[model samples]
Target: MTYDLVVIGAGPAGMSAAIKAAKAGAHVAIIDENPVSGGKLLGQLYHEPDSGWWVGRNIAREMIAKASSLGVAIFRKMEIWGIFPKWNIMLNNGERLTTEHVLIATGAAEKAIPVEGWTKPGVMAIGAAQTLTNFHRVKPGKKVVIIGVDPLSLSVAQELKMAGVEVAGIYPPPATEVSSDKSNPKQIIQGLSAMAHLAPNALLKAAGKAANHPTIKNIAAKCYPSFGVKVWGIPLHLRKTITAIEGEKQVEQVRITAIDGNGNQKNGRTKTMGVDCVCISGGLYPLSELAEAAGCDFVYIEELGGHVPLHSPELETTKDGIYVAGNITGIEGAKVAMAQGELAGTAISSRLGLLQKGSDAISEAQVKVQDARANAVITFQQHIESGREKLAQCWHTNVQTSSGKG
Candidate 1:
């Protein structure tokens, strides 16, 4: 089959981009490996403290409906293995599809920090547990201990509780004793600072506004210590770490240890908690293997989930005709992904000559995308704003050098 644009991964990003491009008169098709197209979105059921109930279900429904109404073809259960130049894509089902342009919204894969007994049954990623509970109607376990203190892990803990799973506690991953040269102290500070948002809105605002005053900032900082927020009547243990998961046929108990401020174990003090399941969440990283296969330039921006495709602000990768958006661009949330999808879609439509350059529609789309990004609820990772500036600068430099700017 041939199309003007073939989008891989029918998640928020792919669907948004497809809908935008289709509205601009491009024949678009979206393919995903799952039988359904929602991607991780199908599993996300969390509440935003400010926005009341924030459910991915509503967003996914809207995106799918819009795409369908726009006549954008949706193909599921198709795994793409090869992407040759000139937009030839090979599917695992022995079929091939060609397109004038491609957008990879492959999104991200959950990162698992390996601990002993991780391979045992009943041990899974937080995202997996969420899928089983939210989408499949299967409770992951009767009781659970979650290992991670990020928003995703915390939110999943509450979701699991609502789904009838008894959550023991949420803890941070075992801290590394050895520090690498690549480690950025500022990033650690930034992450810790952002943790204040987990508190009530008033506290978050106080911390942000008081940052300039060292005395006030110190007081504000003191207000937030690890695991400061309780969700669904569950405690998030910030000063604790999971040493191991113990089980025979399935998960039984987890060894928890207390750590000092430096992440070093404190006097070998250990505690054991009995649980039917253990959820490990090291974090999230972009699933950029396909983009790598496409020969896009990659740069290691730790802030944007390790090595991401180096692309222009327009969302075009170093390789022509291939664009990216969503978590694959960085470790952001569904809303950001939707905004990015809109942007990439508009850019692709303009590039395909379906939309005139400098047209009102294109300008409007760009403005809307910018608004969406600015107002996003979750913008994790560090240096995202400056990192984007760096991308633009590098892209401009490359273009000027190619054109003999010197």
Candidate 2:
């Protein structure tokens, strides 16, 4: 089939982009591997201080409704195997899609910490727990031990607790070759120190801010409360590690121990807590394989969640007629992904010569992207602002080099 624009994800970003382009008179079609369009939005349930409860599935339904009403084609349960030159997307079902423009909003994948006994049935990635509890309304287990302490794990832990699941504790991951820096106690403090603004009280807030200093980070790691500090009545064990998950067929218990500033287990007092489930969070990274196969330039920016496609502020990838948005561009929340989708839609419409006020519309959309960033709920990386600036610089340099060659 042929379309003016084909979007490769049905998440918030892809659906919103389709709505934008379709409204601007561009024929659009969107595809996804899931039976529904919500993507990870289906698993998101959180209560912000100001925003109240954010039920992401509800928001996703609204977007899907708007896009379907706008005549944008929706292809559900479809997977794209690859992208070819001059805009051809090959679906895994043996169908080929030809398009004038392509947008890769494939979103992100959860990184996992492979601890001992992780292959057990009850052990899963933090995302799987979120999906089972929030999306499917199925309890993962009676008692759960979560490994890793970041925004996603923390938010999901809160949700699991609200769902009546016994949250044993939220502990840091084991320091392995894959992610030693993140697993280290001091490194985690340096990263989380940037989130001090989200601290509830003056005391914890001050502690978070103070942990930013190298000397203070070491002190904080060593002096962390043995029982852990309660945030929302859930124990966040910042200086502890889950060494092994033990079970015959499913997760039964976790071997946990206290760690010093280096994350090495302290001598004595290795306790085993019974937990029917274990959720491991190794953070997230951009899913950019589609972009790479499509011949776009890439750069690794840790702040942006690993390697991402080199794109402009307007979401244009280096490859002509190819665009990217949402987490595929960089890791942010659903709100920012939706804003970037809107921006991408506007940019694609303008390039197609369908928008009469294209420049003005693009400029307006850029402000929305910035505003979305300011109000983002879960900030995975502390230095997102710097990551974006670096991305923009890379884009401009590539553009100049191409122009020179021509």
Candidate 3:
């Protein structure tokens, strides 16, 4: 049976859009690759106490229940491999879905820093580490070194500490200013302060002592100016780059050397650190491949990562009858994602005649969604600009090797 709307993700955005459309009397289907329905939100580490953004979880869960009540079909463990021009989706599990309307909300992927030995078994991204501790209840390692200084990295460190794992220290990559454009300075500062309060210096020092054991002497605390006051007492080191990773069965030691701003290694200035796990957090990238393939027009905005497709206030992409929402559009917290999802849902309902067009209710809802989207854009722009130089450097090297070949 052809569906009125087929959403290509079960995360907050897809779920929200599907529920709204289904409740409006449309035949709806939601598809996801994971065994369970919830996306990264469910698997994320719960380090900070109830931040407002986390409300998306409950909202998404409610939408799922509502959709089920409305007879909406939810398909789990079904991966969509391709999308045709006519909006026909090919699922890996031998199912083909055709829908009159399509919404892409596949979400974003975590980016990894290209450092020597980063591909080794002990090296993992911050997101991977969160999946281990939060979802599987498994600690990534007894002694761990985190390589970023954002709220996400800080949250990972706190969660690791709570799980009885020793965080050797947080090694921020470099000193970069927080972007004023993309951040709600007041709220971000408050969150950072609270994260700092959770793990005081005394606590980090104790963990350092435990990690400094002869067997684990490779662990050390190094600081970069970019990490700010939140990450104090970790041994401070600068202008260093990883040279090589050494170990037989598992990660045992890493060789690093000082380097100038020009990416040149300093002569005879090298150091080694012993550690079992290296968690890197470069940042996130927009997973807009499906959106792009669906004929959405993209513009390279420096503050929004790269190649963010232009979309209407309702999250509708340039392609008529197609929409984009959530992290697939840009990187923002879960709260902003939920707001976008709701807005898209309402717009779809109006377009399909399920809801009256341009009514007072729809107008009010649109305003709220637009405001949230505006704020999120500003915050995300700041983050992208803050790391623009490093990101550009990495992108240049990546392009030289990948050659625009996916």
Provide the TM-score for each candidate, comma-separated: 0.88, 0.96, 0.74
Candidate numbers sorted by TM-score from highest down:
2, 1, 3
RMSD of each: 3.5, 1.5, 10.2
Model 3 score (lDDT): 0.64
Better of 2 and 3 by lDDT: 2
Model 2 per-residue lDDT tens digits across residues 1-406: 9999999899989988999999999999999999989888999998777868999899998989999999998999998888988888998889899997999999999887899998999998999999899989999889998898877887888899999998989888877788688677677777665556566445356566766676776787778777887777878786788889998888889998887778777888588998899998988889989899988989988889899999987898888888999998888899999999999999999999999999999999999999999987678777899999999888889889999999
* Candidate 3 Cα deviation (angstroms), residue 164: 2.1
Please identify model 2 stretches exceeding 4 Å from their true place: 200-204
Q: Which candidate comes out best when scored by lDDT?
A: 2
Query: What is the TM-score of candidate 2?
Result: 0.96
Badly placed stretches (over 4 Å) of model 3 are 45-63, 173-243, 256-267, 357-362, 370-406
lDDT digits (tens) for residues 1-91 of candidate 3? 5788888888877787787778777788888888767676665544233343233345556767887899989998887878886788888
Scored by TM-score, the top model is 2
Q: lDDT scores for all predictions?
A: 0.77, 0.87, 0.64
Per-residue lDDT of model 1, residues 1-406, tens digit only: 9999999999988888999999999999999999877898888876566677766767788888989999998888989999998889999989889997899999999877777788889899999999999988899999898876565776688789888899888776776542211122222223434445554345334544565466665444344465544556786564567888998787889998876544455777887888989998767899999999999988877767778888877788988899999888888778778778888899888888888663566567667766765665555654566666666677787778867945
